[model samples]
Target: MRLPFTHSKQEPANTRTARKLCWDSRDEYFRCLDRIGVLNPNDPTQKSKINANCANEDAKFDENCATSWISYFKEKRVVDFKRARALEEVNRNVENNQQAKGSQE
Candidate 1:
């Protein structure tokens, strides 16, 4: 089942990424429900149902609310991805240099 507050198919990718992060947070909002044995994690619609419910519970809940929550998670993920990308780039450079040196030898 879809979460109560989850966005519809029309929602943008950036919006989806943000919501996914919030749902994935340590607060375990989603995890708690999963561990409690309520919803199936494998179901794509579950998250949407949960989000929609959360949105309904709070009078202030809106697209912007989801947007803000998702933004924080998105930012953190982006930073982590950037760091990983940088490390990978460095490793690639080092490997290339080693290969070049080995060829010279």
Candidate 2:
């Protein structure tokens, strides 16, 4: 499930090192997920797949990031992936349109 992205001024892990740790763990976990083609970490249907494939990285990610940030980061990853796919589609369409125009000239 995707959560709406939000910007919060109050971050519990405000230190640079803590933020880095969270990001590192998150990246590792997401890499594992990507390998298994799992998008939503919180999805109950994907829990077994995640546990079997990414238990170690998932555990580290949970340990490093705050409880609030865990869900936020997972949801944000899905949202970001979808956004990037949409952007790519838009770019492809624009390129196709330009090519068509050029061919007509």
Task: Name the best candidate (by lDDT).
Answer: 2
Q: Which stretches of candidate 1 lie over 4 Å from their true place?
A: 1-70
RMSD of each: 11.7, 7.6
Candidate 2, residue 72: Cα displacement in angstroms equals 0.7
- Model 1 root-mean-square deviation: 11.7
Colliding pairs, model 2: none
lDDT of 2 by residue, 1-105 (tens): 434446542344558999999899999999999999998898899999999999999988888887789989988988998999999999999999999999999
Model 1 per-residue lDDT tens digits across residues 7-31? 5622323466655543545234434
lDDT (Cα atoms) of all candidates against the true structure: 0.51, 0.87
The candidate maximizing TM-score is 2
TM-score for candidate 1, please give it. Answer: 0.36
| Residue 100 lDDT (model 1) | 100
TM-score of each: 0.36, 0.84
Report how far residue 92 has shifted in candidate 2, in Å: 0.4
Alpha-carbon shift of residue 16 in model 1 (angstroms) = 25
